[model samples]
Target: MDRAEFLNRLEAQLLDVPQAEREEALQYYEDYLNDAGDAGDFDILQELGTPEEVADSIRNGLRQDSSAAGERSGQADEN
Candidate 1:
């Protein structure tokens, strides 16, 4: 798929995520694609995998970050 289609699919998959996070992810990918001027859409897709895969990665990363932040906050509270 092309960049637009890939981003659309990713946005659809990210519907359950918060708006700010979703937008940030989309913008990050958009910038990534723009920076890859030498690569074609297929190449980028191949490197990144499908939108579902990318969205899952983003979600997983967010979950890990959130968990870490919560743990830090809890430790601070206990101190």
Candidate 2:
């Protein structure tokens, strides 16, 4: 899909997320597209997978990072 359509759908899908988080996530994808465009790698879209899949992966990564950070915080508290 075109950028506008992709973004509209992405925004709709991420409506449940906090506005700041959703904007950050959308910015990341926009930057990804910009980088790929600069590198002449339009095919990156196909390889990077579907938008929903990409969003899911991002959410998983964020969750993992948050979990790790919480663990680290807990460890620090114990020390």
Top candidate when judged by TM-score against the true structure: 1
Q: Which residues of candidate 1, in runs, are more than 4 Å off?
A: none
lDDT of 2 by residue, 1-79 (tens): 6655666777777777678888998998778777767454447666766677777776777789899999999999999
Q: Candidate 1 — worst ten consecutive residues by lDDT sum?
A: 36-45
lDDT for each residue of candidate 1 in 1-79, tens digit (9 for 90 to 100): 7888999999999998999999999999999998887467679878999999999999999999999999999999999
Q: Compared to the true structure, candidate 1 yields what TM-score?
A: 0.93
The model with the greatest lDDT is 1
The alpha-carbon RMSD values of the candidates against the true structure, listed in the order shown, are 1.1, 2.4
